[model samples]
Target: MDHIVIGTAGHVDHGKTTLIKVMTGIETDTTVEEKTRGLSINLGFAYMDLPSGKRAGIVDVPGHEKFIKNMMAGLSGIHLILLVIDAGEGVMPQTKEHIDILQMLGIKKYIIVLTKVNTVDEELVELVVEDIQEQLEGTLLEEAPIYKVDSLSGTGINELISKIDEESQKIERSNSLVSPRMHIDRVFSVKGFGTIVTGTLIEGTLHVNDELIIFPKELRTKIRNIQVHEKNVNEASAGMRVALNLANVHVNDLSRGDTLASSGSVQKTWMIDVKAALLPHAENPINLWDRLRLYIGTREVLCRAVPIGVERLEPGEEAFLQLRLEEEIAAKKGDKYILRSYSPMHVIGGGVILDTLPTKHRRFNEHTIETLKTREKGSTSELIADFMNRKEDLLTSMEETASYLGMPQTEVIEYMGEMVKKNQLIKVHQLYMSSLKYEKLKKDITAILDRYHKSFRLRTGITKEELRSRVASNVKSKDFDKLLQLLADEKVIKNHETISLSEFTVTYNKYQLKDKEDIEQKLKKAGFTPPSELELIGDNKERKELIDSLTGKTIVRLDSETVMFKDYYEEAVQKVINFIKQNGKMTLAEFRDMTGSSRKYSMIILECLDKNKITKRVENFRLLY
Candidate 1:
């Protein structure tokens, strides 16, 4: 069953709270001050059983001119709204402002309930209804049914409830089953329940014994119990007004704007990306980097609006924006937010979050703007896929990705699994990246190595760490490792504790300028001791530099950090291969006996041949592969 929250909005003392009381026999105004003053000062809650047997939560908001902020908080979580206008007075200042705010908040499904109809004549009530029609002409409620009700007389009270049920039944139920995130609109302590927080569970499920994290303060607590409309339940789903009995958090640590969520799932964010359009009838223009008040889910934050691709957001113009907030907020992508001017507190426009965790962007950045537009422009599933594809490395945290995609992580996990089976992408652990990026990285590394081989023909292969440093400009570490592994899988590169090019080779056409016989005699007498390349060059200055360059390239090493020239390695390889062929496989003792060298020299020569893959070292014996 869908958990729907219904809220009332209209001018001050317009019978919003009174109508709720008549419909549900529960006085929403709980405070003595509210009863004495005969006006609601804060939000009130009431619930009723619909004919469909689904329980709907009623949030009664204050209609006074001074309590619009409180009204915004109450209406933020409502799935369907009741715009209660006084029949006698028709639309007043606060009534129009409340209606404009509801439209700006992106409240699409609403019913116009003309309250206090019994206080006015029937003909006058019809005129008031016509006036409401004009007020809602271009908004979401233009076609909404107008119900006349008098809370004092209880007239049309049943009809209002029926209409709420009828409209709520039409809304499609969301299937998200992730960790719960409830924006706390009311925080107080119940005598035995400890600290209880009440609000709409906007996403996921809440259950007893679930560990939760309250954001901004990030206090950890466990849900001792769950309550829906004063009734205890084992589990609570999204769209329901719930009160969570917290085990550890105190009442003073939490407030109205704070959010309670499952630990490790939701992170507090200080910046968000949005795709917003200024209201065409906005009183003032919104300039780039303008400061504004952002109201999202039940939290109001002061934010700097950095417009994307436009310096000044003219009336009716849409653009991507990065909002730098003064306080941390728990917001997801695609969540609607109302943006208001800081001073006048008038709703300038509203927008949907495109990127929850975003870096600051400069104006007129075409690519970033276009990308945000795609997320704002596409359907929910399409946007999710696009966001995952852009991440490139599937290694990004699932929680972060969910926040970036503006959906519950559980929903993303389910859809990601489907996408993976369809060959759209892959998930390793909790991170996701496009399979295309994985393949492209391999091709890029292959191209890089191919270029290095062509340019530096003298070197055997480059070091792996050095390659990573060089490729950092183009590829990230996670992506680089992923590509290297892919290349190794395809046998395009060889991994020897380090990555090496597949076709890399050492050439000595120039190094063999001296006679082979003369070099061998010199190296054999040196006996594990090799002359420096420059010292062996005698008087040729050009030849000295050339041989010196070969010192680091294709050279051989032995124990004690001793180095041998490439010419020596070449000679020793041939000798070792010939010995292996003649004797099938020679032991170290037999090899040393044949070579007429010391144990150290014998071991060094044997190891050099092993390093070059000329022979395999096994205990005391060597074998030719």
Candidate 2:
């Protein structure tokens, strides 16, 4: 059966509680204090079955001014509202306040109910109806039907039930794909049960044994049992008043403002960005950085409202704002919140959240304001695109993006796949980058290689580490490697131990050619006992540069003080092979004698042969491998 929540809203002694009892045949007021005083001080829950067989959960909220917070707690997850008004008194202060709150909370469906109609004359009842119609002229209830009913006598009750059934058929059930969110309005302990918390399931579905986290505290617990409308159920979907018997959670640890949600679905944040509007009946203009009480999803927190791009927000004016909260709250984009004055404790303004997790923004920053505007008004894909574009060169993971946007990771991955297919985003090693940023990185890499080629014309290329240090040092090593491979595949650059422009090649000038020749001759004449690099260069900067160029090109091999030309090194290898073949195994002294070189040169040559795997030292002798 489809489940819908109908919340009562009105003034003190307006018969909201009494009206609910007559209609549902279930007494909502169960607290001793409420029963003794004949006034509800906390939220009450009951359910009724309509003639059409639809189950409707009823939330009877306290109407006294001091218990407004308690009333606000019951307002979350409501699909339909029953605005109860006293026929004898017409509209009162709390009545108007409740209307303002309902509107601010984004409630669209409602039916105005004039209770205690039998206490007033027919003429007075008609006048009260006219007054209600006038007050609802510009609100969501302007076209709503107003019914007169006496709760005690059940007068006009059947007509009201029929209307409710008709309206319930039109209201769509909440989407089960959204993450499950239940705001705890009441937390208490039953004799046999561990800890029981009751609230309306606003979204998704909760099943037995489901692990959930209570926000702000982030206490982890599991659902031991589930009850909907006072009956055991294996699962409860959105729009049902549910009492969850929780395991590993103490009643003392649970609070009314706490929200139970699927793990990783909600996050606690101390700051949020929103598109806010001050109510027309606000008592004072909201200046920049004004402290206020923020109410959202049954949570009340103290926060400061900072108007974006303006000094103050006048009554009824809408603008972007950043709320700096004094405590963390679990909130998300599109969640509606009410703002009340800190001292006067009256509803002043409210708005929908644009960003649940946001960095501290500077007031009047044009870019920040423009970004917020896009978030407020853009489509989902557009918002994701903007988020990626803002990241620029930094690649964002899907998890990070999902957390930032307050969406599920699976949803974010789906969107990212679409973006990648459209070429609007680039995916490298599971990291995402905007197309613009990818192009910029490619360009920067090309420029860096071009500069390196120009500076070292006599060398092959720069080392990969050096290239990375110069160009993409901030990029992750794995991601940078993937990017380099991509560039190599595109023939934009060449990747080896070193990176260089694809078309780049080392060229030797006349001076460099002469120096290279001179160095080759010196190493060749010295044979295996070549002069040390310092001795060969003799402080000649040009010679040193030439030596470095030759070594970089693999034209010269240097091992400590010994240097060997490539061709000569090949010849030495051949000689060693010949000696080993002829003698089977040769001692180091015998090798030195055969090489016709000094002990130092012979030792270097033997070491090089050993390193190249040409020969192995077997104690007193060397053997060719």
Please, what are the lDDT tens digits per residue for candidate 2 over residues 1-625? 4889999999988999889989988888897888999988988888899999989999999999999999899999999999999999999999999999999899889998999988889999999999999988998889989988999988999999999999998887775656788888888899998899999888778999999999889999999999988799999998889999999989999888899987766658899899888998898988877889999988899998888888888998998889999998987678899999999799888989987768888888999988898899987678777777765346877866775565666888998999899988888988988888788888988888788778777666787777778767788888888888988999998887578899987678887777778888887787767788888777676676566567735455547555677776777788888988998988878877776878877888888888879999998888998
Give the range where candidate 2 is weakest over 10 consecutive residues by summed lDDT: 552-561
Q: Clashing residue pairs in candidate 1, if any?
A: 333-406, 394-431, 394-432, 394-433
lDDT of 1 by residue, 1-625 (tens): 5578888988888888888878788998898999999999999999888888878899998888777778888985678888888898988988877877787677778888888888889999888888889877887788888888888988988888888888888876653555567788988898976898888887777788988788878888998998888889999887888888899878888899888877655656899888787888788778766889988878888988777787777887787778889988976666788888998777788878777656677667777877777777776556656665555333455565565664666677787777678766655444565666556656767787888777655445566767877654444565556656756777889765445577565455644544333444564567545654544556755443333334444345553344565565676667768888987888877766765666777777788667767789887789985
- Judged by whole-model lDDT over C-alpha atoms, candidate 1 comes out at 0.75
Pick the TM-score winner: 2
TM-score of each: 0.75, 0.76
- Segments of candidate 1 deviating more than 4 angstroms: 191-193, 263-267, 379-394, 397-403, 406-431, 435-483, 489-492, 506-625
